[model samples]
Target: MAEEDAASKRRRLGQEVPSGGGVGEDGGDPDLIGRLPDEVLGSIITLLPTTDGARTQILSRRWRPLWRAAPLNLEADFGSLTLLESERVASQLCKLLSAHEAPVRRFSLKCNGRYGLSQPIAPLLQSHRLQDIQEFELYVRGDLPPSLLSLSPAALRVLHICSRPESPLWTTSTLSFPSLRELTLVDVDVSESALHGVLSRCPVLETLLLDNIRARRVRINSLTLRSVGVSDCGYPWEARLEELMIVDAPLLERLIPRVPSHHLVIRVIHAPRLRTLGYLHDDIPRLQLGTMHFEKMVLVRPSDGMRSVKILGLLSAPNLDFVTGLLKCFPCVEKLHIVSYTQMIFKNDVKCYAPLECLDRHLKKVQIINYEEKRADVNFIKFFVLNARVLESMKFVVCRDKCGAKWIARQHKKLQVNGRASQRAKFDFEADCSRGPSSMVDMKHIHDLAMDPFDRSSCRCHGDALH
Candidate 1:
């Protein structure tokens, strides 16, 4: 009789009862009550959507109360539905949570509705029953009410807050985050003092990312901060931060202890912990350093004229000579890459320091991209080919256009057959350089007086005599 009654309940619940199975064949359906443990059923119900959870009540009498007891997940978008409809959905979600005894683990609310003077957010955040909330993500297209700033910090491990162009909700004294490990502020206009106040308070913060965070001046004094990234922060600001990165910071002037007095200072104060140093700017007058031990470095400038004082920590510089007398700073440099942009001239003055004899010998490889057969460029190349005994290969990347392909091909043939006792120099010319703008030369063709004695191509790299 009991078996027959259980089968009847499975059939009523629209669940299939496996034939020749145990007495509780329909127990696989967690919604079937008395057949499975309540905790197991509650876990299964929590995974269902709010709408689906409500629909499960119609399955059986036991299932009617499970949806209310299960954890709640509320998701609503005002863009698709009317504002009233979205609020109605939120109200139902609140009611469901109010009835539940277990703590809510995750609360995700994304709203695109405009909140004017009439609408309030207290009802959404006043869930005292949600004690186990681990993740809270609030993305509001409109302004956030001041009430949201009072959320319980103990229950939230990760908090992401994004607001549209609206007034801030908290003042510097009122803002507080005690237990946050990671914090991201996006498109939020908060005063510099308020921002620093928040960071100074969050003692355990590991990573802080600021995107489009407009502030007059930002002062960072976090001692435990491991990583910091600031992008598009309008103007000059004093930041005493470690492991720092500044991108598109237009008005940035000074970085703590100004440029060094003498010597190229690249000190890897922490090489094992440092990775990348990327800076892009319109003009950089000087780069002073006490100690910089970064593994990788990248510098992007508007024009080649932007001067850089010294780069001591890295192995390569594309604009080595153009950046003033700083190339000799990296005496320990193992690899060198020189990039020649369009209409950009690479002048080789042997009298300057005999770069071919001095610089190439220490380098393991020399890569010249967009190589043109101008007299100066060729002299620099030949110097590296003959002097760099440790050079394993010299890669001359031809631009996409056929601009310098002919020149590279001719140069490769000449270097290969010359068979001079110099280390058998290898040249590859299967590259194109004409796809871009015309090449720019730095200085006029080297006069006959400037030609080295060993140069067989005369002062003109094109095998033509000097005019």
Candidate 2:
């Protein structure tokens, strides 16, 4: 009777049932996953969360002893636990570390203490099992102990620390990152000299991200850095990062800034190999690149420009002079992306402006995200449509709710589809309501965004109208 009932459920769910024997008994397929070698199974188990990895003991007989030998992945979040509960869990974690014989590979701890009770994570980090940890992430609500930053492991590659609201008071004179390649620090307070010292200690550092760091001034001088991102440091009224000066970075390729305000002054004194830059906005009061300077999105001196810059991003209202003037500083740009949230209204044509090197010969692609087909928006696109002689493709990404067949047709006419300067230029329209206008460069994927970070032409397009 029980076999009949179980067979009925399997049939209803469209599952295959053996006719002559139970599953894996005689006629059914064998358990392939359980047949895997213990080493492979142990590696897979270590990738799971701490609790989930331990729970695998009940999966089957083969998986019972695997978790004990797998490399540890210890993660604890005390935000939901009460004071007593959190202490108990912390004690259990300590005991587990003492008993576990395998090495620790990944450790992540995030917590918001209550009633001024903070859990000390320094002891866990100092454990012998964690000496070879490769990745570590710590996000604490209160101030962190000075000892946390002093520990230097030769095997550590990635370290992300976020101490919000309150910053750490470092007593250590120097912090070392021997093998660290990617480092991200958020809301931590470090003096100008101490910040420089931190960079000096990282010998092979490749990617560095500073987010909302509470420092009066941040200076970067690195020898082996490839990418650097400074985002959301602070506003004008706050006593946070006011000046970001990249004094010297020989191999720097990409420099990205997110949510930059007028209060932040960015100066790139020397970066000869800089190839990708911006999300350049008019809100930034001042930006100094090499010898050229920009005051509120206007290039003060156009004679000095970086020929190495091939990709550029801009966030602004419909101001042709501002865009044209800025492009002069990057003469060899191959791809250009512009993101606009406010309605664009161009009052006049592309006045008596000289020909730009990028538009005349090098420029190949252009994209305008959040295109609304406003008179100025179309006019802004028309400048590139008519002048970019070497252009091969142009795309206007519109929101789904504001796009349709009729709207697309009207845009083709307004843009003068038949009179494009580049005879090979293909115009396309894509409607995507999922996301608003945003730059292509994201800080999370800093290393992967190498050259043409703003180019998203590879993504599938909807409502594509090509001519």
Top model by TM-score, which number? 2
Clashes of 1: 17
lDDT of 2 by residue, 279-358 (tens): 78887778898988988867787566889988788887767777887788788998888886775456638545678888
**TM-score of each prediction:** 0.47, 0.83
Error of 1 at 363 (Å): 12
Among all candidates shown, the one with the greatest lDDT? 2
Candidate 2: misplaced stretches above 4 Å?
A: 1-47, 52-69, 114-117, 120-122, 167-172, 232-234, 348-353, 423-428, 432-441, 449-467
What TM-score would candidate 1 get against the native?
0.47
Question: How many clashes in each structure?
Answer: 17, 1
